[model samples]
Target: MNITLAQAEKAIATAKEKAKAIDAKMNITVVDAGANLVAFGRMDGAWLGSLDISIKKAKTARYFDMNTGIVGELSQPGGSLYNIEHSNGGLITFPGGVPIKNTKGEIIGAIGVSGSSVDNDHTVAEAGSKAI
Candidate 1:
């Protein structure tokens, strides 16, 4: 099943709260299973660079049907599918992107965030997913 607007809104709200808690502005993006954008937000004062990175991370999660951290590991030197990272607009081979799974463990979409440390980005993304 596809991600609904309600889910997107929940994700955005949670992301905003987490970003506020850390006192860090952020760019958050949600993408459907097919890597299509569902929703996006740029917190005030967030770095412009995070705009693109957040989308790329969401796309990475959507494409891989898993967290971007797992994809990053798979793309490391001597790892399988290392070349895959070079495709699709150059997704960053790092953490901070996470998949959103339904109750049956099916991935319906993903969320990503940037404009902070990778750890903080991951925390926000996780918060968003949990909110959904």
Candidate 2:
């Protein structure tokens, strides 16, 4: 199953709310099951450098079927899945990415957030995932 347009919009809205709650300007990106862009939102004053990071975070989560933070944890030096970020044109291995699952527990899409600290990014991304 893939994420519908409405779901994507809902996710973006929630993400924006979370960012605002934290007084953060964020770049949020959502992607479908096939890792295609579904929706995106950039809060005012968001860092320009985070645009691609947000997209790549969503892509990374969808590509691996795991949160980017988990990937980052296991991808550390001498850890499992290490060094694979160098493949696929270099993937983001940090936090701020999550898979969106359907009611039946199927992954439908992914959400990514950037333009803040890693902890804040993860928090905002998790908020967006709730819209699934």
Candidate number with greatest TM-score: 2
Q: Which regions of candidate 2 fall more than 4 Å away from where they truly are?
A: none
Go through the candidates in order and give each one's C-alpha lDDT.
0.87, 0.93
Write down the lDDT that model 2 would get: 0.93
List residue ranges in candidate 1 displaced over 4 A. Answer: none
User: What is the C-alpha lDDT profile of model 2 across 9-28, one tens digit per residue?
Assistant: 99999999999999999999
Lowest lDDT block of 10, candidate 1: 84-93
What does candidate 1's lDDT look like per residue over 11-57, in tens digits? Answer: 98999998999999999999887889999999999999989999999
Which candidate leads in lDDT? Answer: 2
